[model samples]
Target: MTDWLSASAMLLAGVIVGAMFLYGMRRRQDRSDLERADLEAKRDALIARLREAPDPSLERDAAEVLRKLDKMGVEAAPLGGAAGGLKPAATQIKGFLWGAGSVAAIAAIVFFVTRQTKPAAPADPLADLERSVQQNPDNLPLRDDLAKAYLDRNNIEGVSEQTQYVLQRNPSDARALTYSAIVHIIARQPEAAAAMLQRATQSDPNLVDAWVGVAWLNAQAGDMPRAEAAMAEAKRRHPEMAERLDQLMAHLRGPSKAEAVHVTLNYGGQARGMIFIIARAAGVTSGPPAAVKRLPLSTFPIDVDLSAADSMMGQPLPQKMRIEARIDSDGDPLTHDPKDPGAVAEGVVLGNSVSLTLK
Candidate 1:
C-alpha cells in the first residue's frame, strides 16, 4: 500500500512537471512569434517612410532598421520562396525533437515507478496447509496439522479457531485440548489454561505435554503443591523424561539449604486467602526477584524454605536477602493488587525463620 501511494505521487508530480514544461515552451514560442511580428511591422513601416521620402537621413534610418530586422531573423513581406517553407520545416523538426524527448522522459519515469511499486511475494508456510484443510474438510489429521502450524506461528486466534473446530468434532482430542491451553497461557489466563490442560490429561493420561503444561502453569500461578504433583505424575507416566523433569523441578523449587526461613503469618481474620512469599536481595527492589513461594492464608505460621528452585530463571538466589509475605486475595503470585492486603519484612538474612503479620 505504501509503495502504491508513492508511485501514484510520483506519477502525479511527473504529470504536473510535464504540463509546466509544455506550458513554458508554448509561452516561449508565443513570445517569439510576437517579437517576430513586431519586428516585421517596424521594418515595413520604415520601408514605407523610406519610399515616401528619399531624404538621406530617412534612408539611413530605414537601412539601420533593416539591418536590425535581419539580425533578429525577422523575414520581410512574403517573396513566395523556399526560405519560408524551410523555416516552417525547421520549426517542425525542433518541436518533434522536444516532444520525443519529453515522451522518453515520461516513459522512464513510469518504468522506474512501476518497478518500485511492485509488491513482494508473501512468505506464509501456512497457506498450503490452510488450502489443504479446506479441500479435506473431514480430515482430522489435516485439521490438527493446520492447528499445530498456527500454534507454531503464535497465531492465537487461528489456533483457537482451528482447535475449536477439531474439538467440536472430537472433544476428547488431547492434542487439540493442549493446543487450546497453550493459547490461554499465552493470553495470561493461567486458570483457563490449567482447566484445559486438566481436561487434556483426563482425556489421555499418557499425554506428557499436558502434564508438563499443567505443572508449569500451576507453578506460575503460585500453586507449588499442585505444580509438583503434576510434575510427579508426568514423570511417573514417562520415566524416561525423569532427567528433564528433575531439571524443571529444580528450577521451580530453587536451591536446597541446610537452614531455611519458616514464615508465620497472621492474616488478621482473613480465613481464606493466598499468600506469596518472595525473597529478594537486600535493598534491590526493582528487578527480577530472588525467589518466590505461594502459600495459603489458612496455613499460617508454616515452615517456608527459600531455595534455588524457587529462584527465577537466570537469576540465582542471594546469600543475604529480604523476605516478604503478601496476602493476596486474587491468587496471583506475580501481581500485587493495591486493594489486596499484604505485609512486607525487609533486610532479613537467609537460613532463619521470619514472622510477619498481615493487617
Candidate 2:
C-alpha cells in the first residue's frame, strides 16, 4: 500500500494552498466591487453637479469616470473541479481538519467588520441647498435662497441661471424678476433692467428690491426727486429695509458738495467720431483721470456737465481740476488719429465753468 502518511501530507498542503488562493481571489473581488460601487456613487454625484451647475472641467471628469467604469468587470466565478491524483480519504481528512475552521474564522471576521458602521459625515450647506433646488425646480423660494447663496459666493452666472429658469416658468415672479433686472444691470442693459424692475414692482408691490431698483434706476438717470420718492415709499412700506435703503440714499446723493463742471466745446468742422471730457486732479501730470464723459459727436459746440457722477476712480472731487476735452476723429479713445481736436484747461475750480475751443 502507498504510504498513507505521505499522501495525507500532500493532501493537507494542497488544501492549504487552494484555500489561500481562493481567499485571495475573493478578497480582490470584494475590493473591486467596493471600488466599482464607490465609482458609481461618485458618477451619480457628478451627474447631479453637471445638471445643477456645469463647467468645462466637468466634461473631462465625466470622461474619466466612463473610462474607470470600463474596468472592474471581474465575474464572480465559483471555485470548482474535483481533486485529482489524491486519495479521497486523505482529502476528506484535510478538509475536516483545516478548511471548515478557516471558513468559520473568515466568516466571523467578515461579519464583525461589516457590522461596524462608519460615522456619517457632516452635511455641506451649499451642496445641500443645491440638492434641494435640484429636487424641486418649481420651488421659487428655494431657488431664491440658492441664488442668494451664489451671490454671496460671487457666482453671478449661477445666480442669473437660477433666476432665468424661475422667470421662464413664472414670468410674474417678483423675486425672479428682480434678480433678472439685477443681471441686466450687470450686463449694462439699462432699458431691459428698467423693464424688469417695473414688472417686479407691478407683480409684487411688497418687494423691497423692486422699489429699491426703481430708485436706483431713477437716480442713475439724473432724476433725483423720483429716485428719492421711490426710496421713501419703499422705506415707508417696508421699514425693515431702512438700513439698506439708507445706504442707497447716501450713494444716490453722492458727495456733499455735488460740485459740477460745465463745459462748452467749440468745433467749427462738421461732427465726426466722438468727444471725451476728462477731468483729473490738478497738478497731477501723468495719470488716469478722476472723471470722464464720452458723447457722440452728432453736433458741434456741445454743452455738457462733468461731475462726480462720471467719476472713474471714485476719487473725491479735488478742490481744483485739470479739465480736458478731446474730439477723436476715429471715435476710438485707444487710438490717436493726429487730426483729433483737443483742449486742456489747467487749474479749473470746482463749480467753475470753462469754454473750450478746438483749434
* Highest-scoring model, lDDT: 2
Candidate 1 worst ten-residue window by lDDT: 76-85
CA deviation > 4 Å runs, candidate 2: 1-125, 256-359
Q: Write the per-residue lDDT of candidate 1 for residues 1-359, one digit (tens) a residue.
A: 75557656656665655566666666776676676667667667777887787778877776776676567565545343235546744565566566556665775677687787878899676898898899998887788788888766546678889889999999888988888887676444667888788789999999887887787677666688998998999999999999988787766654445334556776646545577777778887644466676665565555666665454331346667777777777776546777676677777766666777776
lDDT of 1: 0.70
TM-score of each: 0.42, 0.42
Error of 2 at 255 (Å): 3.6
